[model samples]
Each structure stands twice: as structure tokens, then as C-alpha cells.
Target: MAVYVGMLRLGRLCAASRGVLGARAALFRTWQEAKLQSVRPLSSREADRTSPLPIGGLSYIQGCTRIRLVSKTVGQCLDATAQRVPDREALVVLHENMRLTFAQLKEEVDKAASGLLSIGLCKGDRLGMWGPNSYAWVLMQLATAQAMELEYVLKKVGCKALVFPKQFKTQQYYDILKQICPELENAQPGALKSQRLPDLTTVISVDAPLPGTLLLDEVVAAGSTQQHLDRLRYTQQFLSCHDPINILFTSGTTGSPKGATLSHYNIVNNSNMIGERLRLHLKTAEELRVILPSPLYHCLGSVGGTMTCILHGATLILSSPIFNGKKALEAISRERGSMLYGTPTMYVDILNQPDFSSYDISSMCGGVIAGSPAPPELIRAIINKMNMKELVVAYGTTENSPVTFMNFPDDTVEQKSESVGRILPHTEAQILNMEAGTLVALNTPGELCIRGYCVMLGYWGEPQKTKEVVGQEKWYRTGDIAMMDEQGFCKIVGRFKDMIIRGGENIYPAELEDFFHTHPQVQEVQVVGVKDSRMGEEICACIRLKNGEKTTAEEIKAFCKGKIAHFKIPRYIVFVTDYPLTISGKVQKFKLREQMEQHLNL
Candidate 1:
């Protein structure tokens, strides 16, 4: 995180010193106030085993290494399970010919480690795993863990040490490597122009070999497993609970995207808490077979998928490169996946498929859907039609390992239909008045503030950026507008900045879009505020009609009548084939806004 901040600082100072200082001062003030809000130091109750938690009392709840390094590292977590469930099938990589047991998977991880260590790769160096989620993808992450401990899991490892199975040979990779890490300065040496990182004293490849990167397989085979195993053990001794795994890229409402640094302890604990609440094999270790087609680059499929299954001695099914609806559905059915999880968009696509009912979706337990407000209609499809008993409406950000709220246990049908649910075990939430810069009371719509163990280490290389989002006491200002009921259920209304004011009335697009989703022909709809001369701004609906169907603006407007207020209905509707999205499958409203404004000549 310091690296990013330093670069931004250097860029600012070198480009324009006076403007840079002023911007920094303003940012620092915004960050300082946020920090103060986080560290308010509130009192709380302690939860543990025999403390009413479903999981056997949490062993690491009150300690720094509370969750323990082994429990957190993907390789270490799988290894622990390998020892206990040696014969149990731990992973089934699609098109890989066979299933790998816990023991076998650990061996693969060890091989990758030996390969890196043989080439003189030191501990705590960053290793980039940029390939698609596959058997080797999991292996790469675990293998890299053996060498680097927990310094870089979700983010790019910064030492320019190792690149993953695929997608790193491009110019983008080279630029990022050299720009982020100072070690690679003056990287383009003689014979290195076509040369892929000849400057790295040592580099290792995963599955295939690159010109400059050392072959991981060859290196691993040449060395002694016992020696590499000992080195792993030695590094594990110095592995602190809070060490970062990797850098994750997440979008900000205002900028391109920023890197979120996630630590081992944060990822592990959050997953543990999730498992406990869901009553996932709390009594005894069960053969919980989990299907993860959500992609390994993401927390939902990687950390959450791995930890949730491990907490119960379950197996992780990796069916990589799950393209569209058909691929995902096939993988889920093939694995007899017990539970499925992904963003709301992915599930919506799955449910909306023409073959939705054909698959044996009966084994699904439940799923967590975020990245956008989940419509009540979609939740009903997952629970009733899809046979998923636990359709949870969750909310969080990448900065917090992307989990903060779970549905309240005693929530009524109406509450669940209207809200995202309650705050999670180790987190606190409050509604902030963004305009007044004050915390608001219950039932009020305001910016949501989250603070807990689930929060990220910080933005990788951007300290000033980190301080801006993560306030004191570690509360992260989500920039999302929400409301907290008296029962503590936090319901997302929209992004704090997403409110489209039409003249004097505030129109939340999510609320209006919900009504449009109720229409049968409307497969997907995005609401954008278009600049209007008469109303200041008018609601615009970007609609994607169901296959072989169509709906006009007039008909859609009629359907929305009596469903929402008069002023909240969209004034303009434009049909489109697709919506622009972020990496996590979140719909980019800003993009939609730009598209509509240009179309209407505003």
C-alpha cells in the first residue's frame, strides 16, 4: 500500500507541486475524520465456543494469530485437511482427468513451492497468479503460498518474482511489474526487448515455460521435497496472522480502480464467521462438497470458497473458465454442488436461462449475492424454483474482504424482501449523513459505514487513498446509501452518490429498477440519470429484453404504474443487448449514465 501511495505522491509533486499539496491536504482531512469515526472505541460482547455460536467455539477469536496462519493460508488450510482426511476427495479440477484428494493437492502445492525456492526466491516476495481458475490456478496460489507465506494473496506480489500459468506475457504485465516494484527499474536491457523479464535474477513458470521465467516443473523435480518442506515450515514460523495474501483490484465510484490488500487473518476469520452463521457442519466435520465456478481471482470463489468448505472438512470443486449460463449450470449439476455463491448478476443470468428448471439444482444450499441490489423476485426464484433454502441478501466491499452484513435471523418475510439484512458477527454499521457529514438515526437513508476484522489491510501502495476509505477504528465508508432498521437489518437503497435528483425529488434507480424487474419481458434493466433541461435530470431505463420478446417504453411505464411513485418512473427507456460491468460483475451505472447522455445529446 505504501508503494502505491508513494508513486501517487511522486506523480503529484513532480507534475504540479502547488495543486498536489492542496489536494493532499483536503484528502488528509477527509481521511482523518473517517479514521476518527472508525476508532470510536465502542463496547461489545465476546462470542466463543459454548457462547452460542454454531461452530465449535472459535479458538482464535481473541488473539492476534487468532485464526492461526495455517488455518488461513490456502495451502496450509488444505494441508491440515489432508492430514485428517487423507482419503477424502478435496479437489476435482475440470478436464483434469481425475480428482485430487487433500493429500494429493498438498503434494502439488509443495511441488510449486520447491520449484520457486530452487530458483532462489526468498520469503515475502510477491507472486502473481493471473490465470483463469483451474486445477493449476488453485495449485499456483497454494504453491506460491509455500514460498511467500501470506504477504500477497489477492493482489499482485511486488518482488517481480513469479508470474502464474497464463496472461502475464503481455506488455501490461511488464509495465505493472516495473512500475509497481522499484527492483525492476531499467528493466528493458539488451536482448531483453523481446526478452520477458531477463532482469529478474530468478523467475519460475507454473504449467508452461516462458523465455525468461524458469520452468517450475523442472526446478521442483530437481530439488529435494524434504528441503523445500523445511523451508516452508521455517517461513510459516515467521508468518504473522495479518500478512497480506495478494492485491485485489476494486472500482471506486469516482476513479478507475484501486488495489485492496487483504491479509490472511481477515480472510480466514470472515469465512469462519460465515460458516458458523450458516450452521455449516457445526457439529462434526462433514463431507461438504462445494462448487466454485465463480473464478479464483475473486474472494467469493477463492478465500470464501476455500475457507467455508475447509471449516467443515468439505471438498472444493473447481470447474474453471465457466463462461456463460450454460457452463456454470453444467458445472454446478455435475459436481452435485451443495451450495452456490456469486454476485447477483451471475445468479440472475443463471436463473434467467431458458434451461433453468432442467438441471438438478436441488443440492444447492444457499448463496450470497451482492455487487447490486438483489430483486425480491430473483431471491424467490433461487429459494422456491431453484430449491436453495438459504438465499441470503449480503452487502460488503472488496476493502472489507467484501462481507459485512448477513440477513437477520428473525427477519420477517417483508423485511427480507426489502432489505440486505443485518450486520455480520464482528462488524458494526451506521448510516452517515454525507451532506452534513454526521451519523444518522435508524430508519434514515444515508451512507453506510463498516468497521471490523473483515476490513482490508489497505490499498496496496496508496496510503492516502487507504486513509480516505478506511477511517479511524478501521471503519470504511462504503459510499453506499442504506438504512438500518430497529432490528439492525441494513438495507441497501443505492450508492450514496447514485441518487438521481430529478428537480427537487430524490430518485434511487435501484428502487425504480426493482419494479421494472417484476415485468415478465424485462430480463435486465439499468437505471441512469440523464441530463434533462426541464427536470434537471430525468430517469432513463436501459433495458435488456428477454430472448424472443420485446417491451416498449409506453408498456413498461404502464406496468410500473402503482408500483412506484409518479416522479420515480423512468422518463426515457432505451433497449440494449448488454450492460457494461466491472470485474466483479457489477453493473457500471456511470457507464450507463454516459451512454444515455450522449444518445439524448445532453
Candidate 2:
């Protein structure tokens, strides 16, 4: 007992001398070890099934490998909202069956900061928020940013990466770290890989703490009072609008992942825009609910979906650990969900269910879908029959906080179904001629460019790559093919580079794909144009039918009758069961196109 007390006193003295104290906390290492020693260890699968978060200080270092920002960007947004709605329920994990009010969330965030500081974690640390849609995961992201200090930290946010370990153990973490960064191969133990990664000395796992990782709660308990409060103030003051907020690694199914650098302003404003579009400002809690099946690493999942729900004082209902059609509809009904927002495939997944209506979705307010050009008929089913008349069509990229354009609730049936809607109130977009930055004539389809609050900072560790996408004036080259009409409404046709030129006529897959979405038995579909001999190119449809359903090319062509022009319909149809998707849920249509071309012997 004397030895334990003596060590605690010595650690406190050392902490005081270093000026890294938060709220005085008991070092939890001894306590947790004792507690855990008493409980039987669950098998790896059972442990995973219990908690999605990694159990360590890995959250502290998740995003810090390349520190991007300086202030409490999103955290401040939460604070501002919490000031007015302190008692409002901000987060709820339906499966965990736990809810946190804004004030309660603040308290937990503060405690997390204190814990992070008690350990050697300083500013510019990488803390991974890898988990299913859960409250704790969200809290880890904000809290790490809040506790950043000028100590031995390098980066402040985790450059987004997938958790490699099926189950993490502390002893083997160094081995795991190698898997994370093969470049660290030559680095000496206990030293950073480089000065560019200053303050990126730790990896805070949000789930099971690995052998080489620091247990999260233990760090919190070990932190001194001064380090905690100083971090709180640092977070409140350090985070700013232009400061980097998130470094989302574009899912690299196509190629190597590119790090998309999002600013606090980008994310905060993105959420604000969605809230504004939906009229979701500080609404009463019970009257609002957001249901989605996307992972938080995706732009739509973070800025538009969860943050919008949090800002509006609404409850966020996470749909699944994995995409299950039955579970999605059930979550909506179980939560009496007001809003269902996700990729077009998500909706298709639900509709494919044999008994989608079995879920109690009577309380749904409507839904929003992105990821692909939504079939208008699918939109009609979600909004009209599913009773979500207020559903909207929104468009964006990871570089734009994932939202730049949106459809308004007031849009007519045709407008809502056809156009991607107008530029958001604070966002501006222009069509650029194929050559240079020339503004295209009104109603001319060309490259879509945009700039506004929601634009990201730049790409992390890839200045050349960033410059290629974003212009000198911060306008992002969206690469999307779109035409703004006389009313300033923007209709996305397809990607500029993705356009198919058959003989002389230009074919945009999205426009043609919309026609396929209306088919009754077409559960999911992607339109891609393949090279042709005389025509230069020909269109094809990679189709997925609903369960217990069948579709023929003739039947699909008939469904497109009158609804689409003759040349726009896919000449080739290949049924598929799955798609290659990015972390954000966008299909890798290019890959699909390649496969289809091979199948067709084109």
C-alpha cells in the first residue's frame, strides 16, 4: 500500500512539473488490471460482439499521424448547439441502449480529454475512431482534438484507416503497427518515424487495447488535474474554422487511397447546410430521428448524416454493424425514425427484402439517397409510398465535406426526381468548359466546380494531388458533369471523364442509369458504356435483381419505354449480386465497367 501511494505521489509530482495536469484522477492501470483479472476473458468474437471500439489510448493517436488542424472545430459546433440545448439528447446507440444529452456529452468529453492528457499523449496525435456508428466513437474524435497539447505530439487526427486486427492485444501492437506503416520498419523503438509527424507518438485504439497500446481508461485516471483543464482550454481555443478537422483516406478500391483533408469549417458548415435544407435546426428531440447504415469514416456518415442529427437535437439511429435489409427497415420503425438517409443501394437493399413492410416504418419523415444517380421511381417509392414527401436529392464529394448541392423540399415532382437540385444557400457552383477554366454557357453540361464553407482544406501529405483537384482560389474541380438551368438548378449528368462517346453522341451513364432505377424488378443497377467498333461505344447495364425475381434484357428495355430515349437504354445487361464500394459507399463503377467489358468480349 505504501509503495502504491508513493508511486502515485511521484507520478503526480512529475505531472505537476510538466504542466500537463487535468482533473486529478486516480491512475486506472492498477485498478483496471485488478478488475479485469477477476473477470473471465471472453473469446475474440464475443469481445468484438460486445464493443466495437478498440480498448486503448489508440484513440489518442488515431488521426495524429498527420496532424491537419489547430482548433476544436466540430467540438465547438457541438458546444454552441449544446449551450442552447443542454438537455437535448445528442447521441443514442440503439443496440447499446444508451443515450447522452449534450451536457452529458460535454462532461464525458471533458473526462476523456483529462484521461488522454494524463498519459504521454500530446497534440498532433493520431486517434482512431474505428467503430460501428456508436456514441463513444464520435466522442473519441472530438475529445482527442480537444486535448491536444504542445508536448511530444505530431498530428492531431487519425488519417483514416481500417482496423487491421480482428482482435488487438497490447503485446503484439508493435507488430500491428508495422502492418499499419511498413515505412516505420527502420525506425528505432520509442521514436517517431519523422518530424513531419510531430506529436504523432501514440495510437489510441477505440476498441480492445493492444499489448503495446495504452489502455484508455487507465490514461484518463492517471492524468493529473492541470493537464486536463489546460487541454480543455487548448481545445476550445486551438480549433478554428480553417484548421484541419478530418483526414479521410479515400477508400482505395480504384487505386492507392488519397487523404482528403477536411476543415472544421468544412464539416461544421456541411452539417449546417443539411440542417438548413431539412429545416432541422434545434428541433425537439422526439420529433426527429436520423437513420443510416453508412460507416462514420464516410463523408456522408460524418458531416451530413450524424452531425446533422446531433445539431438538430435529434437522436441518431445506427442501422447496422453490417448491411442487413431487414435490420435497416426495423431500425427505422423501431426508432420511429423521421429521416432515412443513405446511398441509393441502401434503399435498394431494403426494397429487395421479401418483407420490408414488416418493419414498423409508420413514423418515417422521409429519406435521402446519394452514392449513385437515384432512379426517380425509387425516389418515388421512398418519398411517396414510404411517406417521405420531404425527401431531398443531395450531391457532393469528400473534398466538399461531401455536400455542395442539394434538392429542396419545395421542388416539384419533376425537379426533385430529375435535377440534383440547386446550390446550397452558402455554396456556389459553375460549369467549366472542357478547355481551361472557362465558364460554360447556361444549361451546358460540362465540368462542375464549386467553392464555399463546405470545401475541404486540401489533401493530407499530397500537395500535388490536392492542387490538381482544388484550384488556386479554393474552387474544387468536382469532375462531375452537370448543367445549371435558368433557375440555377443543377442536374448532374455524369462524371466528365466517365462520359461515353458512341460515334458522335455523348452518353452520360447517370442519365441512362436513372431510366433503369424505374424498373419494377430491378433491385440495383449500374450503367456503363463499353467501346464499340463502328459506334465508338455502346451502353451496358450491370443489374442485380430483387430476391426471388428475374429480368430479361427485353423486359428491361420495355421498362425504359417512353421513360427514356432509345439510344440511352443499355444494350447489354449482366446480372450481379454485389458491387465494389468505397468507404463512403460510392460504387466503383469503373471496376464494374471493366468486368462488363470483359464479359461482353468488347
Candidate 3:
């Protein structure tokens, strides 16, 4: 999990540990006045009813649950919930000192959607949102799109409007926007005509307006007119559940980012299913408060955090502008937040706080631990120290609306710690032999593939690229090496792609190697991930310098300063004469990683 103070981005369990489940019933009773509708202890067979195997005993599992899928658009779902719980608190941003009821949040979202339309943003127009987690981020996320990787994403998607904060930390977003579209200096507000970004016409500043940019307040006010309101109403009528609603960037091995296009149907149902697993549907609006510290740009925040709350009428408390351990702890105590959403690393940060014991996090009954697998020790700490007994693990890629598997609240401690839980309701998962392209037997590791409503439509405008991962039958090849037992519990063993997940951010080694190849003194570069105590995995770059040329690690770090995300920069840089090679001359990255681990004593 990345934490940013200003404007810049910075970068579980054994069977014996199952003792905590002994008091599971008591824990639920404390959280809810009445008995929970579905908190009963479940045997392993009762918890996950994996379908019987076929004649071949293939590694396949289809989720079987009484709950049916919700077939409505995201906007429609929010509208229905607002009507049911208009007086209930829908959002609370503590740092911003902002709180909104369900009715008020719906009003704000509709007004913002109108504002976007008033500025010539029509249906299907791509709009990019850039900033820290805030009320504004949530508003724009529901109104339109949310993204990062400014220049590359803007150019790739041909965004019609870009909404960003004035500045974050030391990075001046206005200045960065100016660099991308210098015409902003001379053009009128909402009339940007840039030679570099021809498709981008409107620039929106969340803070004070800059030259040729419209202030967010101005956009919101513009929609107050009757004429704009009528247009907004007309536009909503044309919205469809299958229409693409979000474009999240995920790095590929091809050294460029692929925009995973998600539709309203994809996310709305996915979030609903997730809420069902957490038993959020059983709690009232007053009883469920979710403390979310994850950044809104990722799926964990947008789909898992925001949409789930909307679907279940749960109050969402923005812990802080960014991920701050102290602030998160304070929010739970002050707001009586019932659930906390974060990665294992985030849990570590909170648990390590010197005054952690002083805070009253007992209100936190459960949340999600995602991004990467959690160690058994960390799972124990979260349950024992933080009072997150119902916490569960989630697994998915951006392409699948971000969540395909999640543990039920009543699952055994061993299942929660060892696997990513059973397949979500209405989804199908199967493991295939990497080389044979055939289904694998149970308990055998293979490439995991998913087929269901959760999968993305395709990579935005990249048909060929989309075909590489998504098959004709709509099974998205996750490229994750996983094994599924007869009970349908899945364990991720490794990745087919060399994507280093530092914190929660995914960094592609090929992308970094491509960037390093541009360095003057670098002849070849190989990037790999090494074990990291806090970050799960840290990047280590092994470079072969050009003949008779030399460069220091500091020099390489300096070169990467503004060129890529700060998290992608290698934590360890090694100069090598040549990489370990096989008899056939292929570079052996495993051997290279072993050598680095020995060198760093990690």
C-alpha cells in the first residue's frame, strides 16, 4: 500500500491458529444487536460446496450459492439504495471534514455527472481522475473514471477531460499538465487545444483554477442550470449495464500498460458478491462502517471499497487522504468503524505503531487482506492483536473487476490463511497445465483461468493484446500458478510473469528493463523481485554495462527519478559482467535472483 502525505505517490495461517474461531459467535453478537443471520460455524464441507469432479477429476470449481447476481448498473444501484436509506451516512472523509448521507451523496454524484455533461463530456467519453484518496476522488470515480500514469494513460485512452489536484507533495500536477498540453497556457477554460494531446479538450483542477483550466467548483455550479439538468437526465436514460464504466491500467510483459476496461455489470455484481461474502448485507447502515485506507485508483478501492459500501448501504470512512497508520487507527476509534480494508503491509504498519495499543480498534470486526498473499504470522497478528477475526483474503487481477475469490466470514482459520478461499458465486475457475493447454488434476499447480461476469470486456482498443490473455470462450488467463484442492480452496504458488508486487503496486520487470536499455552506459538489464519483509517483494535490477563504460547505482537511481513511478525504481542495483545463461544461451533469472539474495543477505 502506497502512502502519500501531499501530492506524490510514495512507496496468513496454521491449523493450530484456528483457536480464534472458537469465539466467532460471541464476536458477531458484539458487533450486531441481534444475532447475525449467517454467522453460524460451518464445517469445511459446508463452507465450500465444490462440485463433484468429472471422469477426469479436473481442477475445476464453480461457486454454488443461494444468492443470485444483481443485474443493475452502478448508478441505478446507488439510486435504489439512496431511496431506501436516504438518511443514512454514506461517506465520511475525516481529513476533509466532509460527511454525506446517502441522499446527499447521490445528489452530489448526479450534480457532478451533470457538470461533466455540461462541459461537453458525453456518454462513452473517457475522463481521467488523478489525485490522492478524498471525497473529490470518490465523487469523480462514481461520476466517471479514475486513473494514474498521467501522460501515458491520457494519450493511450484519448481522455476527453482530466481532473487532478493542484499539487501533491513536491510534484506539481498543474505543471505536469502544462508539460503535457502546453496549449493550456493560452487556451480558454474547457477549450484546450493541444498539439500533443489533441483528444483532450477540458482540464479540471480540484483546487484553485490554473490558466485555461476549470475549477471543480465551477464545473459543479455549471450543472445547477435547468438546461444542464435536462441534458443529464437524458444522458442517464442512454446508459446501459454493459457500457464500459472504468479503465484501470495494468502493466503487461510487453513493456506498456494495458487498460483493463470494466463495465457497470462487471463491477456492480462483483461488489455485491463481495459484500455478500463479508455478510455486509446482514448489517444495517448504522451497524456497518468501513474504514478504507487503500488508494481509490486501484480496484481494491474503487470496486471493493466504494461499490461494496454502496451495494450494502454501509458507511465508508476515508481513513486519511492517503494511507496513514496513525490516522487509520484514529478513524476506527472515533467513528467506530466496523471494518478496515487494507493489505498485509498496511496491517503491519498499523500493528507496528508505537501507540497502537492506545487506539480502540476493537470496533474493527473484519476487513480484507489483499494485493498479495499474507504470511501465517501476519494473519495471527491481525486476528489476535487487531481484533479482525472475520478478516478474509481476496484474490484477482484488474481484468476480472478485481475480485474472483474471497473467504467467507465463517471459514476456518486454516482455510483463511492458506488459500484465497472458494470461487465467488456465479463464477467458474479452473487450472490448466501451462504447457499442454489442458485442465490439470486437483492439487496440481497450473495457470489459473477465470470465466464469468467479472471478466473485463477487453483491453481498451487492443484487440490483439486482449486476445493474448482472454480466450474465445471468455476465460481470462490470470498467469498465476495456483493449485486447487478438492474442497475448491486455491493457493497461489508463483506467477508466470515476472511482475514484482512491491507493496500493492504491480511492477513489470520487462517494463523496467526496457527503460534501463535506454540508459547510455547500460548494455543489458534484468529486473527481478527479491523477498521483502514489509513489501512482500522488492525490485532488484541486475545490469550489464557497455564495454569500457561504468555507472554507479546512484547515477541509475537519479536517471529514474521522474521517468517512472517512484515504486518501480529498483531498491537494489547490481552491476554484473554477464547474466547466468543456460546451455541454450537463455538468461537464467532464477540463478540471478539467488545470487542477489546471497549478496544482500536478504
Candidate 4:
């Protein structure tokens, strides 16, 4: 035993010295052999059933699995909604001053579909959209929605055509395209042979045409002139609910984003279900006007915000091209918007605006505050100040067409604020012990796993990677640590991978962040672990203070000293003006770690 220990020390010493390349190579080989000897790989069948214990009892809850799903195509759903409410306003772009009733919107959608078909785009063809939300954006989207669900990850999924804006505000999208396809300047609109993007044959531009891109209006006109009604009808007739529509990239807070490909059936039902949760019914005469400020690139915006509104014959009001608090406020007041959608940070910013009280947002009765868990204070403030009395919370990932859990209307303030509410109909969730990989008892903190109609087909073109998160029995491991009550309410605690181990102590950063949020100066707080040589990892707190508030790191530590365990107290504290967030409004903690590492020169 002494000789083995001495040999391990000698190998480490040799590997650390630059002159001993041969010894370093030998040491690495020995380490690899040791690792291989220590671990055994699970068989395919064993891996599928993660629970060694039985599947029944307190470990799982199948959410209304017997409920029937909407078995219609996206286009069919839109057509049906339009038929039911032809004269009702279907969409309103407040920024563009464009109002289209259901019938008019359907007409535009059919024309756009015909235009896409005329331009050689067929069923199952990939079309990429890159721009902020607008009427033109919606037209192009629904046009594509007729045949296919537009995916978010274009390059990874290898889209056949791309429809993007020539420019949006300060962003020159065309200029970036020129960099990728230098020959785009010389190539024809429909026949592009670029080295960078070989699969791309067509480039369609919204608002205006670029040198190598076709104009959107021209596409619509081309379809109008073509004798292709039969062809469009043929494509629609053969379409199925199970067909792949869109591939949304999971917001990569910890690692590289994976493309979660969703089917038409997946999104259509998910959107309708979410809409139902919002008390929207197409049969009702009361118009549900929704003010959406989130981006089109994410499921939160595309599925929950836009598609849900369309499915329920609700009038969707786009506040602005991008989220502007002022524009959102104005749209809600002017349009008499009954619903509003945004993240907690967005709501916080809107609440912080000095002239916020000046706007009359009395029309807003309900909306969703999703992407992250909303603080209790933020929820109360939104209800009290923003007039969102029926405001609820939604929780899910991009992989599930985005919503698996939601707070329903009848839920009390404490239930809505403390928990993410009950599971959606036709879905199933389970809590598995993180270390044991077996089912845990109810109310025990464990990894949350989901299975249902909402789960994506898989990560696009990466079956192995897809298999890693989604088990063989079709359960997609959420990686979120959560506790489920007997009544089925779930309180998300933290990420499984995000769990911090400091000197053998398990620490969940979310708990620390939640406690820190109670501090008077803290507007927002994110806790992460930094590498430490003495311990495995040390807790670091990154905080965004409330406007005009002042506090020191020492003050924060002093506050935590007596209230919480010493092991959980953040050793490092940082004050920042803002946090790095994904387009969907989720904080990118990995970016924070990188910044902290750079700041500490670790």
C-alpha cells in the first residue's frame, strides 16, 4: 500500500514537470486505466428504467394521461379558429398599426403558404426565420406554419431556406449574411451555391429585398399568380400531427445548446392547453387581447405567447419589435390588452420605471411570468401595480414545446408564488433520487423527469445526446431539482449539475439566491460556485441591486452569518448592473462563471 501511494505521488510530480514528457504520458495512461477499472457502464435496458425500485407509489404522477389530444395540423387549427371567429380581431401589431381579423389573417396565411409553395418550398423543407416580432414576421411564420414548424437552430438543423430581415434597428442581418456567404452578393435569389451554407438554396427577406434575397411581398405575389391551389391542398391533406415542425435550441445555461425538435401535434396541443389555462375559449365572445414582448426565437414567445393567442382566437398585440417597457405599457393601455406576457426581470424593470404609474394598465387581468421562478414580492407587486390579478406562473423547457407545469386560475396567491403549480393534462412527471438514480418519496428533493405529448421528438441530428437526457421509456430528464407535494405542486430548487460541493457539503445555489433576494438592496441575485483549491468549490453570489440602493459585500455576508448555515454563505460577492441572459429571458449562469473566473484570474 505504501509503495502504491509513493508511485502515485511520483507520477503526479513527473506529470507536473515540463521536462518529463514521457513520464507525463505514462502517468495519463495509468490514470485512464484506473478510471476504467473504477466504473462500470450500465446496459441499455437497465439505463432505460432508472428506478431500481418499482415505478408506482409516491415517485410518479401521470397527469391526466387519459385526456385526448388535439389531433389537427397547425394550419387546420388556424382555419378552424378563423371559421369560429371570422369577424373578431385575430392580430394587432400596435407598433405597425396593423389590425387583422381572423378571416383576413387566414387569407394572408393561405397566400403566404401558396407563395412559399410556388418558390419550391415543399412539406418537410426547413425554413429559418431571424427577426424581431412583427406583422410581417407573423405572416411569414404562419405561412411556414402551414407546411412546417420553423426551427430556431438553422445551421445545426441545416435549413433549406432562410427568411430574415435585411436589417432590424441597429442589427445589419444582411451584412452578417454577406460575411457568411461572400458570393451572396453575386448569387441569384433562389439559386445560391455558397461554400459556408451549402444546403441554403433560397434567402427571403422581410420589409425589403437584399442583393441576393427575394422580397417577402414578391413571394406572396408569386404564389397568388401561380395555379397551385391543388398542390397546396394536396400538401395540407397529407399533413399529420406527428410531423416535425420546429426545432428550438435549449437555452444553454450550463453547456452547448441542444436542438429540441418538436412536432406539429406537440406545439398545437401544448399551445391550446396553455391557452386553456389562461381562460381563453374560442367559443366565448369576449376578446382576449394579449400584449407580447418576448422574442420569436424561443417557445415562450412563439408557442405560449403567439400560437396560444391564435389557437384561442385571441387578438395578439405586439408591443414592439423588441421588448420596450414603455411601448408594452402603451400597447396594454391603448389596445385594452387583457393579457400580458414577460419574464420577472422585464416586469421588475417595468415596475421600476418612474412613469409606470402614469399608464393605465387596467385591461390586464392575466398573463404568465415564466422562464424563471418569480419572487413572491415580484408576483405581489405585479398584481398590485400592473393589474394582473389572474397572473400565473409556467415552468418547462424548450424541449417540451415549453410548458409542462402551470399555475391555474383558482390557485391562491401563496400557491402561485411558492410553487410552479400542478402538471398539465396528458403529461407525467417523476422525481428520481439524484445519486441513487431511483424514485424518491413525495416531497423529497430530486431530479424532475417528464413524459408526455409535450416532450420533443429528440435533439435534432444528435440521437446519442438526446438519449442522454431522454430515457428509453420516453422520460425526458429535466435536470431541475424539485420537490413535489402530495397534491402535485412542484417547487423547483436548483439544477442537478448546478449543485455545489464545498468541502463535502452539498449546497443548492437557488436556496442562497432566494434568501439573498430578501435583502433590501438586492433586486436580483444569482449564486454559483467558483473553483477553490482548498475545497472542491466555493459559493459566489452575483447580485443586481435595486435602483438607488447601496450595499457592500461585507454587509451581505454579515446578514447571512446568523440566519443560514455557514457552509451556504457565499464566500465571494459581486455587485453588477445586469446579468447575462438568453434571448428567452433566462439567466446564463455559465456566462457568469466565465466572468467570475476572469475577474478572479482563476
Stretches of candidate 1 exceeding 4 Å from the true structure: 1-76, 142-159, 166-204, 222-224, 251-254, 283-287, 408-415
Q: Compared with the true structure, what per-residue lDDT tens digits does model 3 show for residues 209-327?
A: 68899887887777667787676556555455665656666522223456777766777778877887787766655558999887666667767887778777889898886688999
Greater-lDDT candidate between 2 and 4: 4
C-alpha lDDT values of all predictions: 0.54, 0.54, 0.67, 0.66
What TM-score does prediction 3 earn?
0.76
lDDT (10s digit) by residue, model 4, range 1-602: 00000001111111111010110111111111111111111111111111122133575776653335776555666666677778989778787788888777666656556666677765455555565666765554421111111222444556666666667778787787777778888988888888867767777776676788888778767655547544555555555556665555666667767667666577777886787666675225444888888765566766787567667777878888777888888888888887888988888888888798888887778889888767777777888887777888999987888899888766888888788878887788898998898889888899999998988888768999998988889999998999888677888888888888999998988788778878888888888888999998999899999889998999999999889998898889989888887655678888888888788777
lDDT of 1 by residue, 385-463 (tens): 7666665666777677767766632344466668886656656666778788676766778888777777888876789
Q: Which stretches of candidate 3 lie over 4 Å from their true place?
A: 1-56, 143-148, 251-255, 498-602
Give me the displacement of residue 91 in model 1, in angstroms.
Answer: 1.6
lDDT of 2: 0.54
Q: What is the lDDT of residue 473 in candidate 3?
A: 92
Which segments of candidate 4 are over 4 A away from where they belong? 1-57, 65-67, 142-153, 282-287
Q: Each prediction's TM-score against the native? A: 0.79, 0.78, 0.76, 0.87
Ranking according to TM-score, highest score first:
4, 1, 2, 3
